[model samples]
Target chain A: MIAIERNLVTPRWQRVALPIVSLVMASIIAGIVLAVSGHDPIGTYQQIYAASFTADGALTATFIYATPLLFTGLGVAIAFRMHVWNIGGEGQLYMGAVGASGVGLLCGGWPLPILIVMMALGGALAGLAWALIPGLLRAYLRTNEILVSLMLNYVAGLFMYYLIYDSTSFWRDLTSSSALVFPQGKNLLPSSDWPGILLGSFTLPFGFVLGAVLAVLLLALFRFTRFGFEMRVMGDSPAAANYAGMRTRRTIVAVMALSGALAGLAGASQIGDFGHVLDPRGLEQAGYGYTGIVVAALAMYNPLAVVIVSILIGALTNAGFALQGPTFPIGLVGTMEGIILFSVLGGEFLGRYRIRFGRAPARAPGLDDEPGAEVAP
Target chain B: MNADLIVSIAVSAIAYGTPLVLAGLGELLAERSGVLNLGVEGMMLMGAVTAFFVSQTLGGPGLAVLVAAIIAAALAGAALALIHAFLSITVRVNQIVSGLALTIFAGTIGLSSYAGQVWGVGGQHGVHQLVKLDVLGLSDVPVVGPILLNQDAFVYFSWVLVALVTFYLFRTRFGLYLRAVGESPRSADAMGINVTRYRYVHTIIGGAFAGLGGAYFTLAIAPIWTDGLTAGDGWIAIALVIFAFWRPDLLVVGAYLFGALSSLGFTLQTHGVQLPSEFFSSLPYIMTVVVLAAASTTLARRRIGTPAALGVPYVREES
Candidate 1:
């Protein structure tokens, strides 16, 4: 019989080693899935790598996907860090786009810097409002935020369709005959487009820079702030927080709003940085909010790690779009992301416990046999 | 609406509600056994794709072909659930995350879409569809005749399955042990119940039920293939299980209620009840949110119906 023994302190080597093992394990699983579908796994991987990292315009394309992911990842990271499951990142992001696009359209003739700032705020506020529905309900009414937030994604998705496809909302472009024929959102003026930071050949999207800045602020917030201390303590042990008389409900609403704002940035970025028009199909298909969950999980909810992981996951998504075909289907991207998450969860489990092979020790060992054991001091 | 129109709407409501019943019943069993499998959507999609593929390729008599398709779909869903069972039960991954991962892995834009493409079934018309039945040949009778007597075989099967689950949960000795395991695994384990086995079996079976629900979508509803043909029925079904108070008898009622809501948009639009199609399309989801909030408030006060150990992994040594 095999028995799992708990690890008191995770050995330093295992932290680095387990991730590598998980990657290798995930690759094998992904390869098997690809092979079973009659696709060349090695070729697919190499193609994805080349398209995402090495092709001439590939890095730029990757940043296009990565921009929204960064915001959504940070949004999800904040809520998840505080043990608040805000899976409504997708909906929040859509609302964010609606929010930002509305602002850009309203004041497209404004000065460039001011227009960008207003749009960002508009997006963030929209996303925050959307997320607060679940957040407030969770805090006050004790509803399951998971179900509420997740369900709202569909509602938000439908709302976007309504604005563009069904209703003659302000967002819908009904002016020119061509615009009416296509049934699209009014395009933002050229001045509303946010400028990117250029580094020689590749340009860093303005949103990515904002997300990176937020990451530092987030890191500092946790490392230095009293609020962060309370948040972390509350996340780690709610009972302890209750004993300390912390306002649990307030934190839930605040963090939920904050997380939603972050996702809203993603939507704002989509309008300000790239689309300039609210393209529901484009925004919906990318699924940045959902992928952000994967990024946050892979980064272990660390803001700094979220930055690097977003790029990595972004590259994978970029590769998926590049390699879309009858054989290399779009579904493979989500499938691979799921496998990566599964292996990570499994790897974390493996890291925590030592599995002993062969017959069990016939005797129930006393607590003293272990060093610095889990028992209270 | 006229009597004829009302009767047709009720018939469509039953048709739409059948899948919800199947998926809700499956989730009820899993949640009852202390395992909340949120991968119902993913499982349902996998079941749908696989069932569609089999129905197209099997090349047999209609009855045999449908049976094969359904079995394949159940196995596909169960196969996916085994992953969640192992992750949540043995590996001790967070149940919520595990279920979400399962959905992501097999969702519309995931393995199901990949499989549909690989099997050459995407955008193809179904070769065979599940036929509607007229029970007792009562076709000419009014109102109840069409509503009760007319439905696809799967709709009737869903009712039977609900009754079976109700009996299994309330009337049997094993049923008592199952609830005990869900309520307090430590106590159940102390009393010599194999908690692990019970969770694994029920979760897998629950996945099979979700599979059958997905099969209903491709086999009857549209008889055409598309990514996410079930739309958000799987998610709505999850809410159905919750608002039903985890009771199988109540689940049927809730399923039909949502079914009516789901069909409302389509029915109304056909009868010149002008509204945004999206509003009609979104009713079930909006209703789910409203009902779930209501359920949460009521359940919070009473703290009844929900299993004590739901979403918690049972590790014997830790206990």
Candidate 2:
């Protein structure tokens, strides 16, 4: 019989190797599933790689996809590092888009640099405001942020849906000729659109640069700042932090707001750089906010690693679009992601414990015999 | 409101709330066993897709097909739950992370969607559905007839389940063991109770219940397969558990109240009320947040009866 035992101290090598082993195991499981479903697993994976990396314009497209995920992942990582689960990234993103659109649509004639800065601020503020409610509730009222944030996602989606669905709403595209068509908001003003940076033959949106910069900034913050130290201590043990006279409540709110701001920036970038519009349908389909959770998890809540993980996830998502067919459907990518996450979570055990195939170790005479031990047959 | 409108609303509320009741009860059971399974949404989705696929492909009598779909959904949900059980129970991973991973894996765009696409069940209206049944010709009795006596088999089954679950939790020996496991696993282990077995059984059963609820969406509510058809209903069910103070009796009331809130938009529209549809659509989610906030107060949580060891993974130490 196989017996699993817990190790008091796991080696550093085992900790690093487990995640990689889990990823490989996840891929194999995905391959088996694909094969069982009558598709060539190797061909499917090759197609994913080829389309994501080798195909023309694929890298640029991947960057575009990665941009939003990068911001959201960073947001999630920051909050998670402080032991806060801000599941409201999607909601905050929508609010940020709303804020950015408000500025973009109303002040179209503004100068390029000023407009971009204002839009970024607007988006960040909106996200911060959205996150504030749960943050406050969590800090003061002792509410669970996870449930509150999650519930807010649905509320935010409906809020956006109402804005576009209602004809009289300012966000709606009233000038469109056909009222019978599916309701969609107007695009951002041409002046509000983000310019791309030239890289050889490809034009990468400025959002990518912004995301990368933010990642570096966050890494610096975590490493060198007093606030970051406070966050880390508070996250490790709130009671202990309080005992040490740290302002835990303030840190909680600050961490959550910062997280929300990043997510909001992602939302703003999505509209300003890629979609160039505030369409609810497009926003709903993007799901960068949810995908951010996976990115943060895969990166182990490290702000620096989120950049790399986001790009990989972005590539997978981009490849998913290209792989959609009778045999290799869009959902296959989701399945693979789900498998990978499960494997990683399961692998956490192996990193901490060891499995043995032998009889149970003999129990110490006095310790093994409890007062009520005779009750068992 | 007029008698006819009231009756109609009541009927619709029952239909809408049936799934919540099923899922909420399942979560209640799992939490009672000290296993906080956050994968209800994922389990529900898997169940929805599995049931839809089974009903679509198996050509047979409607009743048989419905039963088959329910079974298939339960199996699917159990499979997902098994992964969660393995991770949280055996692997000793953080329960929240495990549950979150499972949900992502089984959510609308994940395993459920993959299965739906592979089975070619997406976009197809259900061929077999759980039709409303009138008991003892009592459906003709106005007011109460359509509201009570004329619900589908799923609703009736859910009612019976509530009773059984309530009894099992408070009256039965296994129920006592399960509760003991949730309250204090260490003590339960000392008492010769298998804490792991209790948690696993309850969590898997909880998953099965969530799957049954998912099947209710396709088989009774819409009779069609759509991506994310449940639309966060599973989350609402989780909130309902907290609102009910983890009691089966209160769960029914909370579920029905949420059900009424969900169906309010359609009911008002049908009656020519000029309220914004979004208001009604967002009410359930908004209320879930409110209820969770209200229930999560330190005093309330203690008084309202959350499982003592809930969400904490138990690891037995060698003596």
Residue-wise C-alpha lDDT for candidate 1, range A1-377, written one tens digit per residue: 88877776779787667656766787899999999889999998899899998998899889988889888999888898888889999999999999999999999799998998999999999999999999998998888898899889989999999999888888988997888568899899887889988877888899899989999898888789987887897777777888999999999999999999999999999999999999899988999999998888787777888898899899999998998997579999989988988998898787777889998656566653543222211
Against the native chain B, what TM-score does each candidate's chain B reach? 0.97, 0.97
**Model 2, stretches more than 4 Å misplaced?**
A1-18, A178-182, A354-377, B298-301
Return the DockQ of model 2.
0.52
Task: Report the lDDT tens digits of candidate 1 across residue range B1-319.
Answer: 5898888778888888998999999998888889999899999999999999999999879999999999999999999999999998888777887888898899878889888989989878998898878888995689988898877788888888988999999999899999998999989999999999999999999999999999999999988778877887888888888788889988898888888888898888888899998898888888888988898887656866888889888866542
For residue A61, model 1's alpha carbon misses the true position, in angstroms, by 0.8
- Which candidate's lDDT is highest? 1
Worst 10 residues of 1 chain A by lDDT: A368-377
Cα error, candidate 2, residue B291 (Å)? 1.8
- Best by DockQ, which number? 1
Clash number for each model: 0, 0
Per-residue lDDT over B1-319 for candidate 2, one digit per residue giving the tens place of the 0 to 100 score? 8998888778888888999999999999999998888889989999999999999999978889889999999998888998998888877777776787787788867888888888889879778888888888999998988888888889999999999999999999999998899888999999999999999999999999999999999888987887778999888888788888889999999999899899989998998998778888999999888877877775474755678888877866554
Supply the TM-score for candidate 2.
0.94
lDDT on C-alpha atoms for all candidate structures: 0.88, 0.85
